[model samples]
Target: MQIIVFIKQTFDTEAKISLDASGKIDAKGIKYITNPYDEFAVEEALRIKERLGTGEVIVVSLGGDNVQEQLRQALAMGADEAILVASGEIKTLDEHIRAVILAAVAKKIGFDLIIGGNMAIDDGSAQVMTRVAERLDLPQVNQVTKLNLEKEKMECWREVDGNREILLTKLPCLVTTQKGINEPRYPSMKGIMQAKKKVIRKIKAAELELDLEQLNGDEVKSVWETIFLPAGRKQGKIIGGEFPATAFELVRILHEEAKVV
Candidate 1:
């Protein structure tokens, strides 16, 4: 089995977000980490390879050189190899462009299975993997919480509106992992040391034989018109008095002011 896992680097969930003068995220002093869901995808790929005892788990990512840190993290988690689709000089990469690059990489390398996070934490678009599946014309399952692999096919359980939908698909399919699939393992010290020696092959987007104009032009499906923080929440009100009086006042407030009644 040859499993290919797609991972992404995103800002740490706890990192404070602020916009610059130009209405873009201020990257300075912000920390980055592997997308939490992608960590699950990488761990699952490692587990599959370990169970099969005769397979390779390759981790692929697309971004600037800074993304190599996340790739190294995946490599430390036991992926056999790492590939970085360098987004050279392209400042704005929308989900469509990202899918184009990733699908192209996957096509070039070949795979028995492909896995990725249900959605990236930063954008939460959840469109890249699905688009890649469409481009590759392969069976795809998303929000998969459980998976069982066999010789010729895979059986998986996906979450659907609070229910689980069981699906069986042939090999060479793609899956986007959701939570509750498996707990990601932390990279061990030994693995960290070993990862230092692992090679991460970097391929520029131009080398993928894609039209540069199309990729930077119409391939971008969306653009960020503005970047700003959500409005701060209003302060809460407290009603203090006798129980019945407070209750009556609260009801009146809800009915007349808040209008939630």
Candidate 2:
């Protein structure tokens, strides 16, 4: 079996991201990490590969050359190879067209399964995986908490609203794994050493033979009109009183001010 994982490079939430004069968060000088949700996706692929005991795992990412680092990390965790799609122009969180383009590339390269994180934290838009599936015209399962495969069929268990649902899809399906799907294994010393020597080939958008003008002509990928950090609020001072009085005051605030009651 051959598996492809859709990974992304995102700003580490712990970095020094701040709003610039343009009112947009600047990525300058910020550290990058693999999309947190994609971790589970990668682990799921590796686990399935391990179960089969004979399969290839390929990690794919779309971004600038900086994303090569993320691919290397994936290799350190057990992926056999990595593919980097470097489009000098950036892709928006909403467009998620990049993932679709990646699915096409993966199809050209051939894969039995394609997986990604349910969403990215920086954008928190959980639409890429499904878009890829749609473009490929394959069955897809997102927000999956459990996955089981037997020969050519896959069973997926996902939590929706507050209930669980089961999804059955054929081989070569797409999926976005959730955090609890599996525990990600740490990169061992030997794996890390091997990762250092692994080749991470980069393919530019042009090399993919895609038309540059059509990149966002039909429908735009991502858009942000304005962004700003919320103003910090002052610490609250407790209003002490008798139990009933305090409860009445709280109720009054909820009804008159907060308007929740």
Candidate 3:
């Protein structure tokens, strides 16, 4: 079995964020960490390789050079090798363009299974992995809570709206992991030392043979017209005096002032 896990670096969930002068996230001096969901995917891939007793787990990420830090963490966690698709321009590309690059990478290196987080936290798009699978013409199951890889097939339990669906998929399938699938393990000291010796293969986006103009052009499906913070909340109103008067005032406010009724 050859397992490939896609990891992403995102802003720490608890980090304070502020908008820049242009109304976009400032991102300066912010701490970055592995996307939480991708950690689960990495753990699951490691478990699958261990269970099989013979396989290589490779972790791949697309970003600038800074992403190599997160890829090294994946290597420390047990992935045999790491690949960083390094491109400064990649940081500005939308989900569709990123997916195209990932699909191209997938085509370059075939795999029996591909795993990724159900969604990235920063954007919460949850679309890139599925889109990569679509471009590669592979079956994909998102929000997978349970996975079992047998001799030549995979059985998975996917979480949908208030329900679970069992899916049996053939080899060369992709699955995006959701939370509660398994607890991700921290890199051990020994593993950390070993990771220091692992070499990360770096590739530029231009090497992927994509048209630079099209990737940066209007072919992107979505456009961000503007970005801004929600307006500050207003102060609460008080209906004073006796209980009956307060209740009547509340009703009036709901019916007339707030217009919620």
Candidate 4:
């Protein structure tokens, strides 16, 4: 089994977000980590390879050179190899272009199965894997929580509207991982040391022979006009009194002041 796990580097969940003077996310001082859901995908791929006793788990990502850190992390987690699709001179890449590049990479490097996170934590678009699947014309299952692989096909369970939907797809399919699939394992010291010696192959997006006109086109599926911080939450008011009086006051506040009732 040859598994390819598509990963992304995202802002750390706990990192503070702020906008620059140009009204864009300030990436200057922010910390980055492997997308949490992508970590699950990488771990699942490693597990599948281990279970089969003979297979390769390859982790791939697209971004600037900084993304190599996240790729190294995945490599340390037991992926047999890593590939970095350098964004090159492109400053802003929407999900469509990203998907096209990734799908091209998939074709360049064949795989038995492809996995990725359900959505990136930063943009939360959840479109890349779906678009890749569409471009590749392969069966795809999203938000998979349970997966069982066989010789010719894979059976998986995904949650939709609080209910689990079972799906069976043939080999060479793509799946986006969700929570509750498997706990990601931390990279051991030995794995970390070995990862230092592993060479990550870097491929420029231009080398993929994507349509240059499309790459430089102004048309995009979506655009972010501007971004700003959400309004801060208001402080809570506490009314102290006896039980009935407090309950009565609370109801009055809800009905009148808060107007929630």
Candidate 3 residues 1-261, lDDT tens each? Answer: 888999999999999888999888898989999999999999999999999999999999998888988998999998999999876765357888889988888778879899999999988999999999999999988899999998989999987788889999998999999999999999999999999898899877788887767777765777777877778898999778998989999999999989999
| Superposed Cα deviation of residue 28, candidate 4 (Å) | 3.4
Question: Could you give candidate 2's per-residue lDDT for residues 1-261 as a string of tens digits?
Answer: 999999988889888778878878787888899988998999999999989899999999987777888999999999999998876754452446676578668877898999899999987878778888888888888889999999999999999889999989999899899888998888999999999999998777676666656765654556787787778896774768898899999888889977998
Please provide, for model 4 over 168-205, each residue's C-alpha lDDT reduced to its tens digit, 9 standing for 90 to 100.
Answer: 99999999999999999999999999998999999987
* Superposition error at 149 for model 2 (Å): 1.1
TM-score leader: 1
RMSD of 3: 2.0
* Candidate order by decreasing lDDT: 1, 4, 3, 2
lDDT for residue 61 in candidate 1, whole number 0-100: 93
RMSD (Å) per prediction:
2.0, 3.1, 2.0, 2.6
Q: Residue 94 in model 2: shift from native, Å?
A: 4.1
Q: Candidate 4 has what TM-score?
A: 0.90
Worst 10 residues of 1 by lDDT: 88-97
- Tell me how far candidate 2 lies from the true structure as C-alpha RMSD in angstroms: 3.1
| Candidate that beats the other on lDDT, 3 or 4, i.e. the better one | 4
Q: Is candidate 1 or candidate 4 better by TM-score?
A: 1
Ranking by TM-score: 1, 3, 4, 2
Model 4 error, position 169 (Å): 1.0
Q: Best lDDT goes to which candidate?
A: 1
| Global fold similarity of model 1 (TM-score) | 0.92
